[model samples]
Target: MRESLGDFAIGRLDAEEAATVQAHLDGCADCRAELAEVSSVLGPLSTVDAARLGDAPVPSPDLGDRIVAAARAEGRAAERGRSTPRRLTLAAAAAVALLVGGAGGYAAGAYDGIPREPVAVQAMEPGVEVSAVAIPHTWGVEIVLDGDGFASGATYRMVVESKDGREVGAGEFIGTGESKMVCNMNSSVLRGDAEGFKVVDTSGATVLRGDLTAT
Candidate 1:
């Protein structure tokens, strides 16, 4: 029931009705998909700055037309070979957020302003995988690490250091071997002078190391 999707998504329905709707969503992929799309459209609006909406600067004259065209194209692509996808409606809402909020520029994605080229870092220890990307403008780098050999229930420290032998950031996280860890080195550590980076365990053993030179 498309009418019930919004109520279910927002917890507005009573427990009995909500449970029944949830069960239907679980068994119906189309309704579940529509719920996700509706959530995307509603979620941003809910959190958006009310003051910003009031004072949002006037977008370009053609921005509205462009957004509609882009949204239609996106909807067509998403709905191809399927029943009408709600993604286009969601896209239109998102496009409004982007254009209006560009005044308060935010990253479109992780590593949004970062350099496109990825610097390959090799794992010094077995069963560890690390991927890192450095951003030139922000002078920041993000590391995604997966360790499949760490102790199951133990807490460990992940450390990052600059090439000049200065400790940039350190954080403790509890993780299992099957999970991925994300580490972000702020601009303080990514000041374009870091020629090397390191990840050390709690015992002060290096798990991964790499050069930061532009690749």
Candidate 2:
């Protein structure tokens, strides 16, 4: 019964197991107290970052509840034989929070408040064009890399530097061999007064550098 508490805390119990846990929760005051404690900490997991970083738009207020409800509606949860440990539960909560935040906003195209017109950065390689567009509220910048010179399966890292000399990892993506890659950059550097950007190869050599503040 106590082990069930962990699974229930993280929403990992199946419908039958969940019913059993609910029945126990209805009677065991200690378990119920612990459950409330866990929820209080994890429930707001989805909205914490948006409130802290930049002015990014937050997900629906009911997002955490909705996620739990959706899991219940699935009728099948993760196996009941394995109870998620408390630490793992917390990590999962954070992961869910991030996924719900970025994927939701990106899928909804909720960049209306942000600038759509891209500020073109000088391209280093011939036929290689790069542009950066700031997504307001979310404090993210969308970087679009296109054209040739990108090696297939090569990972390119885009680093942003703030006006204050602080450098931040803006985004990273692998070349798809299609000559185009679009990535979302979420960092304090881009959110703050960004100074410039540098595209580095796997060996950390700066392949391209451009002043983002320049027209």
Candidate 3:
């Protein structure tokens, strides 16, 4: 069952196997904890573009050895009845290695070759400060928002607009006020077609606007 936790977290297991794991997790606190850890590590990987992975810088041999060492330690811990799952341990180790090897930077639009358009964010209200970048992907565009000073517990929607006035909902998230929020919203509209992005409150009031066309 522990070997299947990694697959379960990534949705790779068949329905029957997943159901069994779900049942086990429901009754086992230790397994639930392990699953949570695995999910935290793997969650960000879901948004990664697999095709661009080959372009990521390779890790040094020492880094590879360290990853292997960490995986072995996790396996030993599992043998001692610890909560760490063997498969999940390996998956987490691989994720760490990839991130450390520079894939993480690529995912964040840090690659020089990748075209990242800076969005000029204007806060409509007095208390909010926001900044963003638009990164184009094969599937669509990824809008990375970094900001502080939003109303706590308030929900905001990101809208992507085209030059012709067509609007598309990128995504939505709850605000945490001054905690320095970082969000990645994706839209099916291509970056070239997108004219700007707007952060709107539930009442349909635009609180923040970023003009991509000007950039």
Candidate whose TM-score is highest: 3
Q: After superposition, how far is residue 58 of candidate 1 from its true place, in Å?
A: 39
Model 3 has a clash total of 0
**RMSD vs true structure, all candidates:** 21.6, 20.5, 20.3
lDDT winner between 1 and 3, please give it: 3
lDDT on C-alpha atoms for all candidate structures? 0.63, 0.65, 0.83
Each candidate's TM vs. the true structure? 0.40, 0.43, 0.52
lDDT of 2 by residue, 1-215 (tens): 66777678788999999999899888655568788877777767756776567776679999999999988766555445246676688898898768855664333223434444344466564545555554433454544343345567888888888788877887787755546555665555544367677778899877667566752
Looking at candidate 1, the ten consecutive residues that score lowest on lDDT are 104-113
Give the runs in model 2 whose Cα sits over 4 Å from its true position: 1-111, 138-148, 190-192
Clashing pairs in 1: none
| Candidate 2's TM-score | 0.43
- Please give the distance, in angstroms, between residue 4's alpha carbon in candidate 1 and its true position after superposition: 62
**On a 0 to 1 TM-score scale, where does candidate 3 land against the true structure?**
0.52
Candidate 2, after superposition: displacement of residue 108 in Å?
Answer: 17
Output the lDDT of residue 88, model 1.
75
Location of the lowest summed lDDT over 10 successive residues in candidate 2: 105-114
- The best-first sequence of candidates by TM-score reads 3, 2, 1
